[model samples]
Target: MPSHEGEDEAWLPPEIAVTVDLVILTLRASVFQVLLIERGEPPFQGSWALPGGFLRDAEEDIYDAALRELYEETGLEAGNLHMEQLAAYGTPGRDPRRRIVSVAYLTIAPELPEPVAGTDAASAFWTPVEQVLDHQVSLAFDHHDIVSDAVERARDKLERTPLATAFVGKSFTITDLQRVYEAVWGVSLDPRNFYRKVQGATGFIVPAGSERRTTAGRPARLYRAGTARTLHPPLTRPTPSAAPEEAR
Candidate 1:
C-alpha cells in the first residue's frame, strides 16, 4: 500500500508553481528603505515591484533560489546575509501567470550598493518604507502585502532576535543600534533604559574593541552583535504607534 501511494505521488503533476521574491530592507539617510524594481514588460509595465523570479529546475532548494533572485536583481552577492523566509503568498489571483506561489524572503543588510536592474527589471531604487505604507507609492502584484509582512516581521524580531544588528555596520555605536530599533519599531525609546536593557540581555552584544566620538557628545563605544543570535530576556518594548495593523 505504501509503495502504491509513493508511486501515485510520483505520477502527480506539480499543482503549484514555485517562485522566489525578496523584501530587501536597509537604512538610507536614517530612513527605513526597501528595494523596488520597475517592471519592463507587460502585466504591470512601468510599475514598481519586489525583486523576484521563477524557480528553475536546476535550483533544488527554495533558500538557494531566493538568494539567487536577490543577487540577480540587485547585484548583491550572497554572503553572511541576514535572511529568513518571510511568508508564502499563494492566493489564486495573486499572479496573472499560472498558479505561481512565491516564497518570500526578508533580507536585511547594513549597506547595499546601487542596484543594477537585470533581465527582468527595468530599473531599481531604494524607496523609503513610509512611502510604501502611506500608499504614496504603488507596487506590482501583491508585493505591498509582502513588504508589509517583512517590516512587521523585522520589527517583531528586533524585540526577540538579534536581527537589529543587521542595520548597523561592521562596527557601530550603541546609539546607532538604538536608532535601528527606533526606525523599525517606530517608537522612541528612553536612551538610558534602552542602554541598560541591551547590556543586561546576555549575549545580545559584545565589545568590538573600538570607539568613536559623536558630533555633540564624548567618545561613544562601538560594538557588534554577539554570536548568540537569539535574544534571551528579550528587549523591552514601548507603546506601539497609532498605525493601522495590516491583516496577516
Candidate 2:
C-alpha cells in the first residue's frame, strides 16, 4: 500500500461555543422597551447585554436553551412567551472570552413586571430601546447590533403580521392598537386613516362585544385579536424620501 498514512489522518473540528441571546421587547407607557441584563461574570461583567448564555451541553436544543435563558433572566416561564428566532451571528471576535456563535431570539411581550435577575446576570430590567440604539446605554459583546436588528424585525412584523396585538391585553380598542403602532414605528398616524386601514385588514381583529369608557370621548368599542396571525391588507410602514443631492 502506497503512502496511505497521510490520507488516513483523523480530521479535527474547530472548538466553537454556542449561545442564545434574547431580545425581549415590550411597550411600556407608550415607549418601546427591550430587556437587558447586567453581566455578573468576567469578560463583560458589570456590562449590559442581551439576556443569554452558553449551551448546557452537546445534546440540548438551541431553542430550548433560549427558553431556559429567558426564564432564568426574566423569571418568565415557557409557554407564556412566543419567541421566534431572529438570526444567528458567528463573526470572529464577537465574543472576547471565546469563539462564540450566538443564535438570537426575539419576542414582543405584553407589559411585564420588573424582572428578577438569575443565572449569571447581576440585574435584569427593561430599558427604552431608543437608549440602546442611540448609545445612551452601553452594551457588551455584539449586543448593540443584535438589538438594532431585533428592533427592525419588530417594525417589519408590525406591517406584515398581527404582532401588535401581543402588546395589549385580551381585549383592546382601536386607539389601543394604534398606540402600539405609533410607539414602535415612532410616528403618529391619523386616527381616521388608521381605523380605515385596520378595518380593511380582514381577520386582524374582531368585535369583543364590549366597550371601554374614556375620560373625554364616547366609550370605545373593545375588540379581541382574531384567529388570523397575519394581516390580509397589511399595514404599510412609512419610508423616508431620499435627500436631494447637493450641487457639485
Candidate 3:
C-alpha cells in the first residue's frame, strides 16, 4: 500500500480563528458616537479599533464571547442592550498574523457610563461617527467598513422597528425620539412634520398620562414604548433632494 500519511495531512483543512467586534453606539450631546479602544498588542498596536477579542474556549456561544470581550476591553455591561450580530467578515488578508473571521455586532443603548480600559486596551473612549466615517480618525483592520454597515443597519431598523427607543428613557418626549432619528440619519427633520408623523404611526407610542415642562417651552407630553414592535407602514426617510435645504 502506498504511504497514506501525506495524503491524510493534505486532506485536513487549515484552522481559522474567530473574533467578535462590537460597534457600541450611543447618542451623546445629540451626536451619534461609537466606542473604540487602542490596541495594546502588535499587529496594529496602538491603533484604534472596535472593542473585541478572540473567542475563548470557555465561551459556549459566539454571543457570550462578544459580551465577555466587550466587558474585558471596555468595561461596559451587556445588560438590557439592544444588540444583534451585524455581519461576518472573512477575507483572507484581513488579519496580518493569520486567517481571521470576525463576527461584528451592533449595540444601541441610552446614556452609557464612561468606559474604563481593560488589559487588552491601552485606552477606551467614545468617538463621533462622523469622524470615523470621514477618516478623520483611523481604525485598525477593516473596522471602518464594519462601522458603515452598523450605521446603515441602525438607520434601516429606525424605519420599521422600535430600535429608536433604545436611545431614550422609559418615558420620553417626542422631541427626544426625533433627536434620535436626526442624529442617526444626520439630517434635521422639520419639527412639525416629524411630530405629526410620529403621532400618526399607530401603536408606535402610548401616552403615559404625564407631562414635563421645559424652561424654554410649554409642557411636552410623556410617552412610553407601545406594545407593537414593528411599524405598520414604515416611516421612510426623505431622499436627499426632498429633504429640507437646512438639513443639507
Instruction: Give the winner by TM-score.
Output: 3
| lDDT leaderboard ranking | 3, 2, 1
Please list the residue runs of candidate 3 whose C-alpha ends up more than 4 Å from where it truly belongs after superposition. 1-10, 245-248
lDDT of 2 by residue, 1-248 (tens): 44544577865668999999999998888889999888899988899998898899999999999888887777777666557999999999998877899999997778888988877888999999999999999899989999999999999999999899988888999989999998898777778878999999989999999999989878999999888888988998765431111100
Question: What does candidate 3 score on TM?
Answer: 0.92
Per-model TM-score, in order, reads 0.88, 0.91, 0.92
If the candidates were sorted by their TM-score against the true structure, best first, what order would they fall in?
3, 2, 1
Candidate 1 lDDT over residue span 1-248, tens digit each: 33445654666555788888999999876678999999998779999999988887854699888888887877676675688898898999888877889999999998677888979788999998989987899998899999998998998888888888888888887788888887777767777777888898889889999789778867898898898778888985565542223101
C-alpha positional error of residue 239 in candidate 3 after TM-score superposition, expressed in Å: 1.8
Give me the candidate number with maximum lDDT.
3
Report clash pairs, candidate 3.
none
In model 2, which runs have C-alpha deviations exceeding 4 angstroms?
1-8, 240-248
User: What are the lDDT scores of the predictions, listed in order?
Assistant: 0.84, 0.87, 0.88
Q: Write candidate 3's Cα lDDT for 1-248 as tens digits.
A: 55656765755567999999999999998889999999999889999999888887744589999888777755566776788999999999999989999999999888777888878889999999999999999999999999999999999999998889898888999999999999998888988878887888879999999999999878999998987788877778776677785343
Output the worst ten-in-a-row residue range by lDDT, candidate 3.
2-11
True-structure RMSD for candidate 1: 4.9
lDDT for 132 in candidate 2 is 92
TM-score of 1: 0.88
